[model samples]
Target chain A: MQRDALIGEPMVRLTGVAKRYGGGVIALDTLDLDVMKGEFVALLGPSGSGKTTLLNIIAGMTPPSRGSIHIAGDDMTHLPPSKRNLGMVFQNYALLPHMSVYENVAFPLRVRKLAEKDIVKKVEAVLDLVQLGHAKKRLPRELSGGQQQRVSLARCIVYDPSLILMDEPLGALDKKLREQMQSEIKRLHKTLGTTILYVTHDQEEALSMADRIVLFHQGRIVQQASPADLYFKPRSVFAANFLGASNILSTTAVGDGIAQLKSGETIRIGSGAAVINNEPVMILVRPECLRIERYDETSHLSAANSVPGQIVSSTILGNVTNHHVLIADGHTVMAQELTRRTAHDWVPGEQVKVTWAAADTRALEPDEMDVHS
Target chain B: MKETAASASHSTWITHCANAWAWFGYAFLVLPTLVIIPMSFNSTDELAFPPDSFSLRQYEAFFLKGDWLSSTFLSFKIAIATAVLAVVIGITAAYGLARSSFPGRGAIVLFLLSPMLVPVVVVALGLYLYFATLGFSGSALPIIVGHTLVAIPFVIITASSALRHMERNIESAAMIMGASPFQVFRKVTLPLLRSGIIASALFAFLISFDEVIIAYFVGRAGFSTLPVKMFSTIQWEISPVIAAVATLLTILSTGICILVTIIMDRK
Candidate 1:
């Protein structure tokens, strides 16, 4: 998915949006975001990061206090949700409990005053698309969680809105079902080619499902890019820490693309990584990038940096084994290894060396420690 | 182990005693009302339990005698009016109090429910004095107004509870799916709340039908409700017809209560 390929009017646009509650609590600050046509953009963040609020504003359920909303080049700030010509799926799969699946799916068309024959045709097609055609006569409560979610998806797409807003629509399901629904939603998006603005706090869900991931923290977007870019080239400490497991080591820039850690270990920083003069910056090294070697073994691989440490703890997580190595007082770097590649399980208190390539380390200004942490 | 066994047996005995006490309380509350059914069919003019030769004469008197039919009609009309009025006011107030917050919301809810907490005698006396001073005495409108005040609290409680349990996102889902606010209320909110609203209406009807204190105080001679007429009859004479009327009222109330219970259970 190339940003340059999405060359048209944005499906949804927000210019300088802000939301302030009573007693001067800011839920969102001067946010400018453009969701391109037919793009699957995810708003990902922790709880209370204004991602849900932004979704509500786009859905027209909540009015932004300061900014204008435009959908498909039409001003929609003053319009209600019904007039926005958008579809939304809620976290709880907010299907009408009193209506059967057929009636629930027909609700949008009925409200639109579509012809009855056409409505039946479209609804049946959508139900079959979501593989819920057999459950049409059943009420929402009679269906399982995944089935109800499918009905909600059917209802949302039956009307064929230009943009679909999903607010953690798979959050209520178990892990297996959630993953199944994720692929189901991605398939729907590909089939329909409708722009989607998905709000989720699950980083893996966003990373796996979205074309673009917009990271939010404290009422503002910290960074927005492709999933790989966000994971590999994050601009801020918060962005790096929020997207994945990161070992942040405090370092002082020694000019050029080099920084020395507080423990006197010098590490090469990736080119184009931002470095501030005479100020402390943080080096973000992902756990997967670190390779653990016994202290006595000669380095066989070419890597830019090596740090001495002893294994303090290790976690076996099915496919991967995570070893936490303490290189200095209160500074531990996590190294992840594939379980099959390990000759034997490394015991705690074993001496080891953690190595990484220079390109894997991102130099970032030590700003914005995680509020949640 | 022996001490534990002894304590378990003691708790079992306490449970049995509690069940017996509950049954006794139920009998004490219901036996007096049960006595009126047989007396309603008494062949003799005197009101007696275990009637001396059961007959329908008391029921006939209740149906065919002085001012009884008209008073019953008046009571039905007032109860219907109260039910309708209370439902309208109560559902609106419940929605407002549930959805939005502003200064004095708690105070408003307390004031709306104050009628149920205040003594009936005090409320009746206050309305009587207020109506007397305003030259508004002796009208069906006053009785309807008084009954609505008594019924509104029940309506609000039932509707608010239903509103509380309802997922607010269901309404938002409708709104985002191209339904207007009015359509959302009509198609989503109202249909989902059908059983609850029906239960509330039934409660209001029953409350207004059985109300005696306010009807006695606010009603005039010509516009007297059924309970008001029954009260005056009991004061003046021990008529067996009063038993028949009591039996009829009891049956109507019990049937309505069963209906309400069924409706609420469905919700």
Candidate 2:
């Protein structure tokens, strides 16, 4: 994609970026990216999706095989990391083992050659922001994983660069600490107004914190959208599957915005470019979006995108109960209900009717294969 | 619990036996030097263990005498110079081997470390011939150069072992934080390997200080390290002074070895 001026400011821009390893392995295919100022963008993917590679490219830690990167209207593609002036928080903390927390936080400022008073003040402020000022004199090894991560945060932001790059910075923390840091990061982003490019395999993190998420697979981004758009209107099977658990059903186009399931059941769907009239296509629907009710075969059981299935097994998740239903065609469909009260009556071996609204499903592109839920 | 206690007692007995065996193995290593120190005090000219009589004249003669005292001083200066040169060369070479990937990198590392695997006699012979033509034969400078060459592999091996465990990203992180290459090496990499660098320095010192054949092969009529001096004194005639110097060299080298071991263990 060619670069174009977008509104008033472009915080970061990557044109035709690429990375190749020693063995001629293409780690990142040619890519382009644009991050607007004050935007919090998440590069979300499964493992080896080139998410971190993209972040590294922007951070100036790793040079791209081809093309250029620009931050704050300056081309920094060929520059060394020190000249780029970008802050990065690594997954492993990367704190200097012998330095105390305050020194780690003050490192970037020291590199900037700021005066002692300015450095001390800036460091104390960032430390206070991360709520780690009380432990300023402690070494990194003395801190817990969560506290170490906060120290890393303080270091990355203390110098106040134009941008911040985080590579799974919270992956090592416990769930509670991870959530807490996520919120703290969001609050910090709001206050700093600095552009951010975060990389993670966790889709939930992307959904919870990002202004927009770029979903990557293999070495390419399959989709880019807001969290709600990705959840409610995914245009590709991979995006739908990766964002959440999705069931892909093969279907043949019938007519009037409807398609025939392989079970010979006609299903209604929304209008989209993923399919042409009378063309074979796949529909992606999430488990929670699907509905399973007690079976009543007396009415011929004909309904739009509805199938008669037997309840095979069920599990009660905290917020929802998940049911496994074996369809007449032998496909096991997953159905989740908001409450156990609605699913309690269903017993193993009992028949049930599975259905979903057509608008909730999307036409799945063949190239965009479903991600394993 | 009662059965477990009984099993613990049996295991403790086995551990005690193993500990005794460990002491026995160490005793074999220690006995030779221990015997030599006492034998150095023998009153008679011919050196003998469980001497007929003990005296301090050996140590007195060693300190107040011949080229022996001057040679010991020369050896210390050479060892010190060798240590510094070896550490600087080894650190840079090891960093290249550990950090960079290039054509012939593996071969270069093999070449650098090969000195350790080659026989000291071969190195001594090669250096002796080279020194003769280079106009450095029988000089303390040649001895220092030769010993530094021998000591470099030890420095490289130890430094590389310590450096290999360091994440390459630490350097990158320093770079990202606006550290130049020199600053990153100094502020980040060097600080992390403090003890390892000291240990490597000590190893280099010990390597040169303990060297005998190289010094013997290249020692001029008057120029000699303590080792070469002691060697000639023992061969020319039996003397307690040589034993006194020998005990000092043993103590110094063994002390350095223990120090390096301790530092490496701490790391």
Candidate 3:
């Protein structure tokens, strides 16, 4: 869907960008990235992952200690944030407390020296776009958290900036409001067709909203791909663990597209799985892909892989049920299945067998920390 | 149940005692000042509370007497100039201190606030000697300069807290919205700090208007401030006109304080 929006030259390019503090602490390591025009890219990471620092550098609020930055093919490494012609939405909404909502939205235009009549027209139109037209006279403090966020959105969009940077803009809102704002922002991105670089620590937000997700860990890019690609083909143990819950079984690659788990159980691998001989690897199986059945059952014979385990616990999550199975070598694998009225409920301590297709598993390189452990 | 009731009643009794103590404290601080109002209405030359006859005679002398009105005008002029000068210097210093981190910043702040910690008489004497060395003593300029020095620390304190409490990201947001640094300061920072700057400016004005130590130390015969004139009169004789001047000064300071409070408490 976003392919058409991604055509043309990259809107933002960072070449070997890096940041280091006075105490020799590395906030951001040297990294390169490109963001296409009109494409929404999410820098997704946990805290201290250098996502916010990268956004700040691109916004020209913080200068990179090394490397260069380009915005719309212009070198802007040394330019001040004011000269960048970008807009930013902060987590706290950062609205001018002394100004009314209308004036706050009008601030960028007023700085640009637009005619008063034109400012009024533009401000009203943008306020209406954000569904905040009636709140023109209210101060930011007078508005609810969601309303304040909308006003901030209005303020940033009123200037028609070429790019927008959002630093966890929905972080402070409740879950329902955050979901609503997520779709609202998606609609705005579609309507405006402007590039956006969003920084967030929320995996679900990045998965649902962004055209592409750039996963960061320890000041480096762990993986950069479509949400589905990252989920299905995680390149490392960290990548597999970060995106979602995965049953990672430490294994040693054997010959003939097979790997032996630590418990000495063998599993079939997909034909595309590139496994080096006698190398330590990890097999990632998502919870939703696993099938759980009674241990005595002869079913799932064609599934290509099965592991015997005891049911540790089962949790009902409204639409789906999660069953935690304790396999050999103290490895626990979670299996999720959609709740069905006719399905048998497995209780704790019940022996079960879990099965999955070879195609559903990803063979990944063990992370350095995991290898040491 | 009995113990709980006794404890609740004990807390209520403590609250009533604290309230009465607070009211008594306020009266102790305010009643002596309020007494000047009635004394200013004395009909005779003697200054007295509850005058035998109510009259504006003291006020008449205050407005018509030698150098009384002139000195008041001089005080206003000096105080306004000091307020403007002090606010400009103080807010700039406050912004610099709040926004940047550099070596020796703490020392710089200590130097700026040193005027407040030092005795006013020492500061006045230092300024008096410095100006005498420069051959600039005994002029209205010296008095204005002296008052600004003392008033600047209060302005810095007020403006610094405002800057500290302000949302720092608004400045960055404005910058990314295509506002130049100077434009951001003018359009965003200044307007956001409007109340704090105004309150501090009024504080500067009040400090300069009421300042007698520095004014007397540096004032010329032709440029005597109202407080300095009042100081001289009280030292020389007990005049009823001084009572009227004191009442006016009290009213002016109180009005400015109320204005400052209102500005600070506004949303």
Candidate 4:
């Protein structure tokens, strides 16, 4: 939420980081990253995408095969985890089973040989911060899953580490509890002013909670940008598809700011340096950006990219209706429309027109798309 | 409804069969021990199960004999040393095997557990020959060493199982919380493994206390263990006093086993 206050020195920096297991499994490629002081960054990716490996590298749990890591202006590439002075929250909470909540939170301070009074005060403060003050005497197994996670969080913050790394910390929780913890973590970050690096496969969580998102695919970082920038201007097809629902169409550049879809329909787009005449390109349009109208109604037309298609299927998803339309070349383009009381229900096999503003469409270089199937 | 009722009756019959088999098994195993208990109280000097009269005469003989008391003390000293040595080596080996991966890990594990797999008689003979060559066959040293070797596997087994049950990330979490390696082991790993360590130590003690073949081969004159003494006594003369010692050994082992079971269940 404090997006304007991100201008500061780099708290953590990774240069040309890579990791390769003995079995030739490439967990991370040459990667460079920087985290500003007090910034909340999310590493968003699918499983096996190396987000966890990157987090572990920063935590000094796993050393990078090649490259150096600098944290708070110190070279820490070979430092052990104990000397890194970073906090981590595992997906399973990883609370000490034999210790009470209070002892679990006080473990870090005790390891530092802090004074007894200071340790007690810090433990109490963190427990209160997480709203677990009443349950400090309870064992980890005696608490609920969410409460155990809160205890893990409290333990992480009690020592006041400069950075906290979370690896899908909310993955084990249900939707409601996950959302609640997300806000709780965000509140903690705001109040503590510690830099955070979060790793998760959930796009919505990253979008809602992160100031910047670094998207990974197949051990490589695809793009790193602000949440709004990532959603609106993805640099590659993977980023476009991973961020949200996107309708992609193969097109060829015909003129300035104009491209012709395979269906022989010309559509205007915001041209970029990559757009050249007679070159093949891929156009990405968000499902929400495409508007569907009955084919017979053409009088209220505006200067926009439009295509005529036949509705293949329509799904009503409470408050929004998704229409899948097949164009002349048999390419399917999806359009999402908000449901209204007076709106017409367009059933399957109905002829319709899909339209969107030129600014809403993005043209990606054809080679940038990684065909998954 | 009829099918459901028929299936329920069928399951009940199977349960009844299983229960009958279990009771028979228990009785078969326990009948010998029960006979020994009665014979331990025999008034006559003969080793008969159905005694003509019951008395504590055999127990009195066991406690009064100088040879029996000295052998018992020697066995206690050797078993205690074996247990301590076994636990020290076993805990370190188990931790290494559980935490690290290196070349020949599987082979090393098999080697550590090879004593349990080999026939005890073979191991006893091998140990006897080796100790004879080392001039240690007549002393308590060879017996203690052999017992320690045999007990190490059990300790490793119990300790390794406990280590496996622990979540590895707990150690990583401790490390990330700024705990040194020694601190992590002492504060996190050791406390979590308390019940397991204690249980394994008890097992080692019992194994060393009850071992017969190795002790028989390695025992020297004036240093025979309790089992060796009993064996010699039975070969020369069938003493009823052996029954009393057997009953006492049974009680000690059973008490230890129950204590281990309770500790494991608590965890």
Give the 10-residue window scoring lowest on summed lDDT in candidate 2 chain A.
A1-10
lDDT of 1 at A19: 97
**lDDT of model 1 at residue B16?**
100
lDDT tens readout by residue for model 2, A131-198: 99799999998999989988988888887778899999999888998999999999999998878889
Clashes of each: 0, 0, 0, 0
Local lDDT at B205 for model 2? 88
Distance from true location, Cα of B21 in model 4, Å: 3.5
Off by over 4 Å in 2: A1-7, A22-24, A297-304, A340-344, A368-373, B1-26
Docking band of candidate 3: medium
Q: Which residue pairs clash in candidate 4?
A: none
Which is the winner by lDDT between candidate 3 and candidate 4? 4
Per-residue alpha-carbon lDDT of model 4 for A208-314, expressed as tens digits? Answer: 99989999998888888899988998877788889999998888999887899887999888643367899887788999988888887772546688888898998
- Measured with DockQ on alpha carbons, how good is candidate 4? 0.88
User: What would the per-residue lDDT of candidate 1 be over residues B60-97, giving only the tens digit for each residue?
Assistant: 99889888999999999999999999999999899889
Off-target runs (Cα >4 Å) in candidate 1 are A1-5, A271-273, A313-315, A328-330, A341-347, A369-373, B1-15, B133-139
Better of 1 and 3 by TM-score: 1
TM-score of 3: 0.94
Q: Which candidate would rank higher by DockQ, 2 or 4?
A: 4
What fraction of the reference interface contacts is present in each model, in order? 0.89, 0.74, 0.96, 0.91
Please give the lDDT score at residue A61 for candidate 1.
Answer: 84
DockQ of 2: 0.75
TM-score for chain A, candidates 1 onward in order? 0.95, 0.92, 0.95, 0.95
